[model samples]
Target: MIRLFITRHGQTEWNLEKRFQGSKDSLLTELGEKQAGMLRDRLASQNFDLIYSSHLQRAYRTAEIIKDNREIKIIKDKALSEMKLGDWEGLKYDDVIEKYSKEYDLFWNKPHLFETTSGEGYSELKKRVIGSLKRIIRENDEKNILIVTHTIVIKQIMAYFEKRPLEKLWDLPYIHPTSLSLIEIDDEKTNVKLHGDISHLENNVKEIC
Candidate 1:
């Protein structure tokens, strides 16, 4: 069996401002850094064979903090990064709601029909993420791995493994920043032992689910 501990990157300045990050980058807020520290504390006793992180700074930084000065080389993969939001990368939530209401609605309400004028489609995002996951798992045998990525990436992965319909993408729970989820993979099957865990935060941050 292989134990995969998947987590979202910590909060960022854009997150606080309720802006879309997409492929854009931002610094972690103080709370975001602390959240990563808390995650390190939570998993201090656990042993991991390897750590994989998205190419984004937020995810890489979170992984570094979790390693806590320990000498572990984190593998960076673009496939693990957040879904590119294109023109919406830096837009505020309220603005996107007002201007791109139809697209945003499809994103959350009917993901199968979701596509962006400038961003990546949900189908492409899911394919890349799932493909990356499969390759990672295939390369290792009976190892514990930690993957630090983004909200959309993690949610799509969980939804895929859980055998949910693509049209019901919102059926997946809100993926809290720095939240952890465990997926157990074996020769026969895969199991989602936990999904979107943020109890360690203890109100240090506010997020849906």
Candidate 2:
């Protein structure tokens, strides 16, 4: 059996500003750091055999905080990075909606039909994210693993485990910054123990944007 503890990075400056941070990078806000500390406390007792994080600074920083003094090795991988937004990177939500109305609409409402000229679409994102996940599972069969990645990456991972179709990508249970999810895999069976859980944040569960 393999236990995977997956989490999204802490809230970033772009996240607070409602900007698209795809492929781009941003620093974690004060609240973001606090959230990571809280997560650290929440999982302090658990032991992780290995930690995999997105090469992006935001996710890597979050992983560092959660790892906190632990001796676990953190491996950064581009496959765990956020969906590349290309021209949409570093742009505000409304601006992207205004500048690329059709594509933006398709991105949010019809992700399965969404396509991008400069960046990757949902299908492309899913392929890489899921492929990385499978690779991790294959390499570490009976160990506890921690993966720190982006929102879309985590969502795609959860959707894969839930057997959800691309059309229902944004179903329910929003993936908040620093949220923790757990998946238990044994042989051919996969079980999701938690999805988009913010219990670690306790009363400080207000969404920034």
Task: Locate the minimum summed-lDDT window of 10 residues in model 1.
Answer: 200-209
Which regions of candidate 2 are displaced past 4 Å? Answer: none
Report clash pairs, candidate 1.
none
- Candidate 1, residue 28: how far the Cα is off, in Å: 0.5
- Residue pairs that clash (backbone atoms under 3 angstroms), model 2: none
Best by TM-score: 2
lDDT of model number 2:
0.92
The backbone clash count of each candidate, in order, is 0, 0
Q: TM-scores, in order shown?
A: 0.96, 0.97
lDDT of 2 by residue, 138-191 (tens): 999899999999888988999999999999888888898898899999999998
